[model samples]
Target: MKSKKIPERLESKRLLLRKLNHTDAPGLYANIRDKEISRWLSGVPYPYPKDLALKFVLTAIAKFENKKRFTFGITIKGIKKEAVGVISLEKVDYKNKNAMLGYWIGKKYWGKGYMTEAVKEVLSFGFETIGLHRIYANVYSENPASERILRKFGFIFEGVEREKFFKEGEWQDYLTYGLLKKEYSKAM
Candidate 1:
C-alpha cells in the first residue's frame, strides 16, 4: 500500500479518505465479497466479484466526469492505506441544496464506530464544502445498526416506508432519516 503522492482527501481520527481509483478493485473484491456486507446494501450484489469491482471503479470515474458527487474509499492512517470501507454522497440536488449519504464498512471494521466517524466527516464536508442544506439516509428496517448510526449523527427519524424495497428475493421496509444543516450545526 503505497501512499499516493497526493494529499489525503478527508481525515477522521482513524480514517484518511480519498477518491476511488482503478487500483482499488483488488481490495474492494477481497473485502466486499461477504454476504453480511451486502445484506443491507442496495447496489452491492451478493457474492461480489472482482470484475464488478472494476466496473464500479469505472462508474466512479464516470461520475467524476459528470460531476454528480463524491465517493470516498476509507483507509486508515498508516503505511498500508488500503480501503476498509466506502462513504459517498449521491443524488446531489444542488438547486434544492440536498444530497443523499450512504456507506458500508468491511466486516472486520464493523462495530468499531468507523462508519459513525466517517459519516460525521462526510456530513461536515457536505454542509461546509458542498454547501448542502439537507442530507438524508435510507436504511432497510431490518438493519437497525445503520439507523442507530444515523441517529447518533443527529438525523431525525422521518418514518418507515412499508414494503418499499424489494431485494434478496423479498420485500422489505426502509427507514428514512434526515439531518438538516441546522441540526448538524447544533450537534457541533
Candidate 2:
C-alpha cells in the first residue's frame, strides 16, 4: 500500500483530532506537565519545560511534512480549543508498512473513553490512509489501563520486554501490542 498525507482533522463522536500548532504549546504543556502524565511516557522530560513543549510542536510539524510521523492534538468538539491529550503514529517504515503508536490523555480526561476514541480514529488513519500493514504500541507493564485500552481495540498481545525502558530513574518492563490490517478491517 502506498502512503498518503494524513488528513488535517479526524472526528469521532465527542472529540476532534487535529494537527498540533504553535498556539497549542500552552495547552500541551499544561496537560502533560504532571509527573503522573509523563511517567509512563518514555522520552518526555520529567519537568516538562515550556521550551520543550514549544519544540515538540515545532518538531511535530516538521515530522508531518516529511511523512516521518503524524501527530494529533485531541480536543473536545465544541468544548474548547486546548488539547486534552495527544496521539501519534511515529517511526513509520514505508518498506515494512509498520509504525509505532503512542498517546497520552490528561488525568482529568481519564476514564472518559477519550483516548480510546482518539486511538481508534488514529489507527484507522494509520491503516487506511498511511497503508500500514501493522501498527503497534508498547505499554509499561504496570500500566493496566493502557493495556486494557489496547485489548479493547483488538490489539494482540505480542510479547514483553523486561527492563525495556529506563523511566523515572528506574528500569521498566514493556508489554507490546499489535494489530494487523486484516484484523483492523474485521474489527471496524
Candidate 3:
C-alpha cells in the first residue's frame, strides 16, 4: 500500500488530534510537568522546564516537516486551544514500513478513555493512511494503564527488556507490544 500524507487534523468522537505548535508550550508544560506523567516517560525530564516544552513543540514541528516523526497534540473537540496530552509515531522506518508509538495524558485526564480514543484514531492513521505494516509501543512494566490501552487495540505482547530504561533515578523494565496491519484490520 502506498503511504498517504498525514492530514492536518484528525477527529474522534470527543477529541481532536492536530500538529504541535508554539502556542501549545504552556499547556504541554503544565500537563507534563507533573512527576506522575513524566515518570514513565524515559525521554522526558522529571522537572519538565517551560523552555523545554517550547523546544519540544518546535522540535515536533521540525520532525513532522522532515517526515522523521508525526506528533499530535490531543485536545477536546470544543476546547482545542490547549493540549491535554500528546501522541506520536516516532522512529519511522519507511523502508521497513513500521514506527514506534508513544503517548501520554495529563494526570487529571487519566481513566477518562481519552488516550484510548486517541490511540484508535492514530492507529488508523498509521496503518490505513500511512500504509505502515506494523506499529509498536513500549510501556514501562509497572504502568498497566498504558499496557491495557495497547492490548485493547490488539497489540500483542512481544517481550520484556529488563531494566531497559533508567528513569527517576532507577532502572525500569520495558514491555514491548506490536500490532501488524493484518491484526489491526482483523480487529476493526
Clashes of each: 0, 0, 0
Candidate ranking (TM-score, best to worst) = 3, 2, 1
Candidate 1 residue lDDT tens string, 68-87: 76788888776447776789
lDDT of 3 by residue, 1-188 (tens): 33456686889999999998888999989899999988888889877777999999999999988888989999988765688889999999999999999999888888889999999999999998888999999999889899989989899999999999888778999989999999999998
Model 2: weakest 10-residue lDDT segment is 1-10
User: What would the TM-scores of all predictions be?
Assistant: 0.91, 0.95, 0.96
- Report the Cα lDDT for candidate 1: 0.82
* CA deviation > 4 Å runs, candidate 1: 1-8
Clashing residue pairs in candidate 1 are none
Candidate 2: regions farther than 4 A off: 1-5
What are the per-residue Cα lDDT tens digits for candidate 2 across 56-101?
A: 9999989987888889989998877877788999999999999999
RMSD of 3: 1.4
Strongest candidate by TM-score: 3
lDDT of each: 0.82, 0.89, 0.90
Q: Is candidate 2 or candidate 3 better by TM-score?
A: 3
In terms of lDDT, the best-performing candidate is 3
